[model samples]
Target: MNIFLVPYTRWRHLAMALWCGGFGLMAWWLVLALTVVGGPKWAPEWDGPILLGTIAAFVSGGSILGEDNLRRTPILKRLLRGVIAVVIAVANTLIWYWLLQLVIPKLLPDAWSADAADASLVSLRYRVGDFLAGGLATGIACAFVRKFDHVVSHVAGGISSALAAGAAWYLLGSNFQGLTDLYLSGAALGLVWGFLFGLITWPIPDSLYTGWIRVLSAVRFGRRIPVDAPDGGPKERFVGHFPRGLDLFLPADQGVAEMHVSVAVDGRGRYAARGLSLAPTRVKRFLERVDIRYDPRRPAPLETALSSGDRILLGEGEHQAELEFIMLPKEEM
Candidate 1:
């Protein structure tokens, strides 16, 4: 669904940000508290970025695999997927941060050398470095965690995260002198980044052009099946009772056929539902509100275009499958 148009979505967006932000604040506080005990000599400078990147990785990764829509997936599979996403996100983030540390100094040598430039100039350069590192790391990490393989989705995610990092650095740059200051800065940056991430990603076109099919019948009520393909190619999800190749698996009862209908999303993000069997497949179009039935017994099978909120009835009895086509607002996918 286009979540932004729903009344509850705003609150959901805020709740997501607050949850991530709270974790960010807690992480920052714990890291700062650790500094008071006096760690290894080289640890102080690296701790904040490391913790920030780690928490941001969790936030980004969690948003994908932990989505409400994916709840129907097996618990073990979901946990495994979540762990994999974490590993990739954290590893990618750390690698990018390390690269930035190595490259930024070389690119802005004057920023690192106190004797070569004014202290303010050096501070400004370091801030710039922070901005670039934070932005690029988070952006690239998000791309790694997302499911779909779309250039627009990747670029949008990267740019949104980069913007979040830049804004965070800009807002909280001046207060890094002491542990308390560092904690405050880190917490604020995390909070700001979470909100900005949500703001940019929640309503953008990259988030909205995809959708899923939800089973509303008694047999498989509340089952959500994704309609889009990862590679942006047309992938038909077969609906049937045979089980092995079907996307929307249904029990073999009443009038359901083996290969009932096929649903797919084209490259341009349009949805099409095609009848595959001689079963009574019907569609109640969203715009017209008219009931249209597809007769697979015809010489040429026909496919009907679907819009958000379109309803499809696979049969006419108690065993019939009621499917609702819902357009999704883009997030991680």
Candidate 2:
């Protein structure tokens, strides 16, 4: 019923909801009580709701989704996803809360005037609307999670979070009345939640891997390729013209395709690569040209088991692209 239901909400959230919600609620009330009892009046009482809400949102929002998809994901990649999820969730919650504040008063003016009518009480109608709006907006935010390496996915998350918040705010009529107040409160909540989640989830960059590609050209460029692959998994990849996709690139003059060759793991977990090049891909060594037997019927693609120091030249003519596989031991790596 809460925003928790938005992202493929299944039985997965029930226990988490109970556990996190209970601690979060208690944590929130404690902060409020302590602040009001002895702390300075300058301290905001809403801090309780923000902290409590952040726990429910953070753990439930990004953390839960990440758990669902953690299979085969590298640690660093997982950290990035969690950070993105937390930020988006927090943005959605704050936006929904602020907007509900403005809208409730407008839709049911009678309720507002009567509550405002009492002069001594805040309207319960607004509270109900705020709760509903928060849940709905949270759901909307959770739907945007995507693959972390994707540039567009991150951009979409940020844009969607901002827009979802705005839409919720507009619905609540937060724009006209107390917009400044809502912005200030929302900004504070976002920063606080963002900082806390960052520390708890992704304290370090634990998923990145580095490797140097020895390019075979006149001035051989040692292009650095950072590969993120699970251990014992096939080093699946493609190599071609830009040399970028090859896990190593080649010179443009060779007329290499975007994916000139394919290297994939076999059923036995051994790697095999064959030239997918439309142009001649036979090479003697690092960059030397070799006249390999050509079978015009199938382009004579040679699929062979690969290992450390396997050198193959791709392409024919004056200048052939060179490819060298350098396997570093885990300790050296």
Candidate 3:
């Protein structure tokens, strides 16, 4: 039996994961601060009406900005995109809270007492609803700012909204019952945090997106034929099982020889392949090193065979040579 592994490479995916994970950690810390550390110091005063309004403002503002920054869209588009994001986030938060309320107590009865569990369940629902309303309102406010037609004013509005939201959350802590409410209350807290944090971090997505797009565009390569024989005859093609777009090409006449192929993109964005032939090897050894780049765009299969040579340029014209070749896509191999 023979096993082949395909080479995979995608820098964009890695960058996106890192960016999202980094912000997620910060969001977690904010929740911990408001619920565990601040406690009574942040709760609302006797004027419930004023406190509630403040909380609403912060929650909505944070949610709008946070989601907009993440999506790499202009704040001016907040009405459409921000509202949609808030609805989705709220729905997801509510579903998560409801599921946890039903499943958590049973899973860890010792962790939560009967009365504590009941209070938590109720508190969670209220927190989810409050956060949803806040997010919606904040998004609406941002929509108005979009009409201003200046980046500076838009940013100032975002900053003001975030500060207002944060202050609101700090004053209305009583609306959220206790630590049990944290799970549901976290979204509301996120609303405030997102608004403030989002304003501060607003420029990040633009810069990051610009840099990321340039790098990806530079590295990308279009489909090209991998030729082994000049005239193109009975050639063997070997494919690897990798789903990503990576392949190798070996020309005929190098009997049982190995090749070291290094691929890179030039300033022009064309993929340049440098092939270095290796010493003769047994059947098993030959199979280990040799791989192919399977391109779906091409009508014919691309295959490569190792030969006795120091280095060979793939695109350079060479005389036709008779050779047996096998073609296989990376995934199938």
In terms of lDDT, the best-performing candidate is 1
Model 1: per-residue Cα lDDT over 252-306, one tens digit each:
7845788887788777877788877767888886355433345636775677888
lDDT of 1 at 301: 63
Which of 1 and 2 is ahead in lDDT?
1
Q: What's model 3's overall lDDT?
A: 0.35
lDDT ranking from best to worst?
1, 2, 3
Model 2, 200-311: lDDT tens digits are: 3322211221122345555345553422245644455666656343565555676556667655654344545566655665534345444432345774675665544556
- Against the reference, the lDDT scores of all candidates come to 0.59, 0.45, 0.35
**Candidate 3 positional error at 103, Å:** 8.6
Summing lDDT over every window of 10 consecutive residues in candidate 3, give the lowest-scoring window: 210-219
Better model by TM-score, 1 or 2?
1
Q: Residue 198 in model 1: shift from native, Å?
A: 3.3
Candidate 3 structure quality by residue, lDDT tens digits, 154-269: 44543454344434444454453443343444344444444343443232321111100010011122223342322322222221122334243333332212332333333322
Candidate 2 vs candidate 3: which has greater TM-score?
2
Among all windows of 10 consecutive residues in model 2, the one with the lowest summed lDDT is 203-212
List, in order, the clash count of every candidate structure: 3, 11, 25
